[model samples]
Target chain A: MEYFFELLLSGLTRGSIYALIALGYTMVYGIIQLINFAHGEVYMIGAFTALIVASILTMLGWNEIAILFIASVVAVVYSMAYGYTLEKVAYKPLRHAPRLSALISAIGMSLFLQNYVLLAQTSDFMPFPSLIPDLEILEPIAHLITTPEIAIILTTAIVMVLLTFMIKFTRVGKAMRATSQDREMAMLVGVDVNRVISITFIVGSATAALGGVLIASHVGQINFYIGFIAGIKAFVAAVLGGIGSMPGAVLGSLVLGCAEAFFTGFVSSDYEDVFAFIILVVILIFRPAGILGRSDISKV
Target chain B: MLELKNIKTFYGNIQALKDVSIEISEGEIITLIGANGAGKSTTLMSICGIVPPRSGEILFMGKPIQDMAPNNIVSLGICQVPEGRRIFPFLTVAENLDMGAFLRKDKDEIKRDIEYIYELFPILAERRNQAGGTLSGGEQQMLAISRALMAKPRLLLMDEPSLGLAPLIVKQIFEIIKKINTENKTTIFLVEQNANMALKVAHRGYVMETGRVSMSDTAANLLANDEVRKAYLGI
Candidate 1:
């Protein structure tokens, strides 16, 4: 029972990070039908920015909580700029081109960003600063959970709730939904599709930055190549949840996280990555549209 | 009022509209009747700035608007009810209506306009919360027109609103169109394949063949012309 609880706690923590990253993939796909392959690099950039900010703030004699707050804010802002620029420079011009061409452009962008970061920052992994204070108030359950794990879960929950409300109740959200349903029709109805697409990238990239900060603090490490593997896993999660469905992305992330945790806990840890892909293949074979995805029927 | 002077549009290498000149006066129902591939729909698309005329000018209220974007054209009070009633399938009827008034900031007026749309199409009011895709074909067409009307457009472009509908439903839709024109005093440009029904309701008629306006006359004159009677009226 104790082992099961430990696995569950760890699974939820990891799943929160995956869920945040997967949302960027899902939303960009929803509006433009493009799988933003470079999103993981945005996450990596977030972590590096946070790390640099923390190191500078610490040297300047800021307190721990203040450093965490300031570092996260700066990282998130920088990631937002990166995301907006990525879309405008890399994706926007190719929008009217063939789907295959756009896809190739995205992969090229992913490679370019990864190499750019490698050249700018060190190729070696750097230690992430642990700024979250250890709480002694949960001593009884501390064996199963940590303070950082609690923080990650709480932040994910709050962000998810806020995102749901915004997508459901706001005007821009309605425009997004409309555009996703039918782009040409949405335009005829007075929607500025370019603005909507840009906003989607901004929001998605900001959330990815948050995920990057949380995961870096939790794992106590950062590297340029980390985004590649993490991004592939989050892509699997998005595919598992129904690529364009927001709630489906979160649910898929949780399922993927829990499956990975249990596999590592009970089965051979050596083949953990293999297990995630195997699950994706099996689920796709059974339901090609994904768990929560509605099958699109083109009208004549 | 709107005017298209010597407008030409193409689909890649093939021309869809060639030297198409048209003029519409305010508070009049102008109908363009033609067979399939006669450039009737292309005329509407050019006016709405979806496909800019390769040459000539499109003047809405005497100002050239050939370079404006589609969304900007809507804000200028020209709205289109596109063919096949392209309502957002997943959105509820009420939500779809709300999207129609997307560019408006007058909150109270938007609310009142919505109420007016409901009164015009009571079936839409009853199915307000239902998903748009689940509605019947006739109902979807009604929602499409109502959605466009929600924009409070001075000029409404309708593309075959009566297509694929029953005779009774077509009559009902035509009655609603006439009511909207007479009551709201809106200028209308209608494209239709059903010549008999279209001519009965229009103040003036233009007969398009291939990619140009082959004939233009008052509705009564076109209804009496020998060629029109034989070719369109099945006399």
Candidate 2:
């Protein structure tokens, strides 16, 4: 029973991180219908940005709280810039091209960013200092919960709430929804479709940056290759919930996270990834449209 | 008022509009009618800058607007209800309407326009919260027109507004189009395959054949012509 409770708690914490990253994937896909293959690298760039910012802040004698906030902001800004540049350089030219070509371009971008980072930074995993204090809560429940876990859950929830509000209430959000639903129609109505697309990338990249910072703070280290597996997991989560659905991404992440945690705790950690991939395949075969995706009838 | 002088449009190498010429005077409803590939939609699209003419000129209100972007064309008060009633399927009816006024900043006026549009298409008001994708064909057509009207365009371009509706629903749509033109005095450039319905509403009309203007005359004259009646109206 105790093991079960501990696994559940850990799963929820990890689920929160996956949810944060999955939001980026879902959002970019929502607006532009591009999978944004470079999103995972944006995640990696965020962590590196945080590392640099934290090191600089610490050298300047800043406190832990100050460093964490500043590092988060720096990561978000850097990742947003990277995402914007990626869209302008890679995705924009292929706007009217075949979907297969864009898919290949995205894969190429993923490889390019990973290799670029590998050359710039060390290929090996490096330690990232713990930015948040790890609080051992739930002593009565055998310390089933911790402050970092609470923080992760709270931060992810807060961001989700804010994002929902933005999408529902703001003008820009409406523009995004319009562009996503019908690009040519949106342009006819005077919504700058290109601007909305860029904003989508920026928002997705910024959220991904936050996820990177939070995960680094939680896990304590990262490598240039860290984004690949995590990116695949989040992509699965996005697909599970519905690629263009915000709430779906969060829901999918939670399910994947809990499943993986239970599998690792009871069955074996070695088979953790296999479980996720199997779930994805099964879901694809059974419910290809996803839990939240709308079924589109082919127009004759 | 709008004028297209020897305008040519192509879909890659295949010319869709070959030296097509027409004029629309202010507050008049002018229509282009023909068969499926008669280049009717191409003429409207070119005016809205979705498909710019390869050669020749389009003058809107006496200013050349041949190279403007689609959004810029809308901002200059030339708006289009594209073919297929291309409503944003995922958006709520109200949100879809709001998108029509995306370039405008007048909040009070926008609200007034929304209310007016609802009154014009009361079914749309009832379904304001519904996703656009779920609307019936007639309702979607209504929303497309209402969305275009939200722009308060000086010139309204409608492409195949009656393409896929029941005959009764088609009558209702044409009635509304007539009301919009007479009441609002907005210039209308309509592209349609329904020749009979179009000629009934248009002050002047053109018959397009194989990417060229086969005939241009008063709507009454075109309706009475033997060639137009046989080839287009199936009379």
**DockQ by candidate, in order:** 0.77, 0.77
Fill in the DockQ of model 2: 0.77
**TM-score, structure 1 vs. true:** 0.98
- Minimum summed lDDT over a 10-residue window in model 2 chain B is located at B42-51
Runs of candidate 1 exceeding 4 Å displacement: none
For residues B1-235, write the lDDT of model 2, one tens digit per residue.
Answer: 7999999999988999899889999999999988888788888888878789999999988999999888888899999999999988878999999988988999999999999999888899999999988999999999999999999999999998999899999999999899989899888988899899999999999888989998999999999999998888888
Q: What are the clashing pairs of model 2?
A: none
The numbered model that scores best in TM-score is 1
B1-235 per-residue lDDT for model 1 (tens digits): 8999999998878899989999999999999998899999899888888878899899999999999998999899999998889989988999999999989899999999999999888999999999998999899999999999989999999999999999999999999899989999998899998889999999999999999999999999999999998988889
Model 1 lDDT per residue over A1-300, tens place: 999989998998888899999999999999999999999999999999999999999999999999999999999999999999999999999988888887888899899999999999869999999978778897778899999999999999999999999888899999999999988888888999899999999999999999999999989999899888888899999999999999999999999999999999999899999999998898789987788888885652
What proportion of true contacts does candidate 1 retain?
0.69
User: On residues A1-300, what C-alpha lDDT tens digit does candidate 2 reach at each position?
Assistant: 988988998988888888888998999888777797888989999999999899989999999989999999989999999989999999999988898888889999999999999999979888898998765454454378777777888999999999999998899999988887778778889887888889988998988889999999888898999888888999998999988999999999999999999999999999999999998998899998788876665531
Superposed Cα deviation of residue A187, candidate 2 (Å): 1.3
Q: Score residue B204 of candidate 2 by CA lDDT.
A: 94
RMSD from true fold, candidate 1 = 1.3
Off by over 4 Å in 2: A135-142
